[model samples]
Target: MIWLVTSICIQIICAVHVIRTGRNQIWMLFIFLFSLLGCFAYLMLEVMPAYWGNRHLRTARAQVAGKVDPERDVRRAQRDLELADTAANHIALGDAQAARGRYAEAEAAYRKGLALGPGNDWGTQVKLAQVLFERGSSREALTLLDGVPEVSRGSEWDRRGLLRARLLADLGRDAEARALFEDVMSRIAGEEARCHYAAFLIERDDRVRARQVLEEVEQRARRLDRTQRVAQADMYRWAGEKLAELRRASA
Candidate 1:
C-alpha cells in the first residue's frame, strides 16, 4: 500500500513537470500507466539531461555526497591547494572548512586566499568576515565588512547585508540590525532570509511576528521541488522546530 501511494505521487509530480515544461503529452500518459518506472525513464531521458547544470540539482547532489562523506569536499580542496596554492584553491578550502564548521581553519584559509589576491576581493573579504564572526571575533568581522566595497544588488549583496545585520545584533546595535534584517527580508524570496529574520524577531521576544514569518516558510517549503527541498532541509527543520517551541510556550 505504501509503495503504491508513493508511486502514485511520483506519477503525479512527473505529470505536472511534463505539463510545466511543455514536454510531449505522451509522457503524461506514460507516467500515468507505468507509474514509477515511467517516471524514472522520464527523469533520465528528459529532466536530467535538461537540468544537469541546474544549481538545485547540483546542490542536491552535493548534499547527498556530503552526507555520505562529510569531509569529501575538504579533502578535495586540500589536495587542490597543495598542488597549486592558488587564490581560488585557497578560497575553495576556506569554503569547505566553513561548511564543516571548522571556523578557525576556515579563517586561516580565507586569510591566505586574501593574501594571494582572490579574484573577487569583496566576496573573499565577506567570506573571511563570516569565518571570523563564527570564531567569535565579531569586532574584527565588522571591520572587514566595513572595509569591503559596497555592492548594491545580487546574492552577494544580500549575503553581505545579512552578515552585517547579524554582527550588529551581536554587538548590541538592535535598531541597526532590525533595519537591515527587514531590508534583507523585503528584497529576498528564499526561506533563508525569512528564517533568519524570524530568528531575529524571536530573539527579541516578538513571537507574533516570528510565528507569521515561520508560517510563511512552511508554506513556501511545501511548494518546493525535491531538489529545492533537499537543499533547504536544514532551514526548514529549524523553522519547524521553532514553530513547535512557540506552540508549546503558548500552551
Candidate 2:
C-alpha cells in the first residue's frame, strides 16, 4: 500500500513536471502507467538526457554569426528602445528580434531589460520567460514567473500566466494547468483570452465548451480594438480550420 501511494505521488509529480514543461501527454501517461519504475525509466530514458541535451544545444546555439538585414533589426530595436526606456521596450525589441528568428538577439534584449533597474518588471519578465520557453527552458521560465507578484496581475500578466499554464500542461500537470487556464478565462472576457481558453478546452477534449468559448470570442471581438479585432478574426479563421479538422477526424 505504501508502495502504491509512493507510486501515485511520483506519478502526480511527473504529471506536474510534464505539464509545466509542455511535453508530450503520451510520455506522461507512460510514466504514470509504469509507476515508480516507469517514472525512473522515463527519467533515465527521456527526461534527464533530454534536459542535458537541450542545455548543451542552447549553449552551442547561443551565438548566431549571420549577416542578413542589418538595418531592419537594428533600426527596429532602436525605435522600440526609444519609445519607452522602460523594460517593456527591451521585451519588445526581444520579440521583434525573435520574430526574425534571432534567438541570441532576443536573449540579449531580455537580459538587457533585466539589467536595467527593476529585474522583476512584469512585461520584461514575461518576454524573457517566453524566450526561455521557446528555447526549451520551461522550468527556468516557470522560476521567473513564480517570482511575479500577485499585485502585478494585468493583461500581460494574465497572458504570461496562460503561457505558464500551457507549459505546465506540456510538462504533465494537466489538472493544475487546466485550473489556471479556467481562472484566466474567468478574468479575461476579451477575444484573445476566449480564443486561448477555447484552445485549452479543446486540448482537454471538451469540444462543446471549446465551441462555446470560440463563439463568445467571436462576439467579444466585435467590440475590441481594431488590431485586437483583426487578431480575433485570424483566431476565428484558425478555429474554423480546427473545427473542420475535428469534424473530419470524427467522421
The lDDT, on a scale of 0 to 1, for candidate 1 is: 0.84
Candidate 2 achieves a global lDDT of 0.69
Best by lDDT: 1
Worst 10 residues of 1 by lDDT: 60-69
Error of 1 at 164 (Å): 0.9
Q: Note the Cα lDDT for every prediction shown.
A: 0.84, 0.69
The list of candidate 2 runs beyond 4 A from truth reads 1-74, 78-92, 99-104, 116-118, 222-228, 231-233, 247-251
- What TM-score should be assigned to candidate 1? 0.74
Give candidate 1 regions above 4 Å deviation: 1-60, 118-120
Q: Write one digit per residue (lDDT tens) for candidate 1, span 1-251.
A: 99889888889889999899986677676688777877876786567754577776566545644564578789889999889979889989999999999999998898898899835588888889998888889999999899998876977788888999989988989899989988887777687878888888998999988988888888878888878777777878899999989888888
TM-score of 2: 0.56
Model 1: how far residue 202 lies from native, Å: 1.6
